[model samples]
Target: MSFLKKIQQPKFLPNFLKVAIPFFVLVTIFSLAINSWSDIFAGDFAKVAEANFNNGKWKAFFGYKIVFSAIYGLYITNKNMK
Candidate 1:
């Protein structure tokens, strides 16, 4: 068999992940939506975490979570490519 034919038959994991990863993400979001959608859509500006970190300073944990989650999502996508 030729090299190209060999590569085409027993495929690599990246090829599987190319489809599986995105589908996993969509399912995760759907699950989260179904679980805490009430709290999400209700616009609950509640203190979900402790803010006080140091001298006269407050950390916006909720905002931090949102930003971190976005970064993590991107990281997961890039990880699969490699």
Candidate 2:
């Protein structure tokens, strides 16, 4: 079989990647919407985000992502097992 054909099969993807990818994408979209709303009604909080990254404060967000992803993964696992 060709590499492309093999990769097209869902069996190759681990369960966690499948669940985490969609969850991450959804969280990203929601975050962007919140940022846009914050920008329109208040001021540009994008600058604050950038400054946080510059100051290494964004590390906390990465931690949040990992924790949330784990929670989502557990929820999915529990649902699938039932």
Candidate 3:
């Protein structure tokens, strides 16, 4: 199929972070979510995430995501937007 031709394109390769970075971020988030859900085995995931965030046991809950998204946005945002 013609679609396969896109794979052979020589543009982003070699320096492939242009494609790999976003994918790695998404997969890492997904894995963290799955592990966070592991507390469901004890039937108490809700309590854990709440304790971590609400009690400030571990800071940067939303902060990490916010900062990462911002940095990723800065790097990934279309330059044409500026």
Estimated TM-score for each candidate: 0.39, 0.55, 0.43
4-72 per-residue lDDT for model 2 (tens digits) = 454455653466567877787787557656646555456777664674444676687556766798678
- Choose the strongest candidate by lDDT: 2
Model 1 Cα lDDT, one tens digit per residue, 1-82 = 4434433544434554555556556655664456456655775424211122233333442245445555554455444442
* Quality of model 2 by C-alpha lDDT: 0.61
Please give, for residues 1-82, the per-residue lDDT of candidate 3 as tens digits: 2323433555424234454466557755664566566665587867757755567744556556556655554444332122
Q: Against the true structure, whose TM-score is highest?
A: 2
* Decreasing TM-score order of the candidates: 2, 3, 1
Candidate 3, position 2, lDDT: 38
Ranking by lDDT: 2, 3, 1
Number of clashes in every candidate structure?
Answer: 0, 0, 0
Task: Give the winner by TM-score: 1 or 3.
Answer: 3
- Reference-based lDDT, each prediction: 0.46, 0.61, 0.52
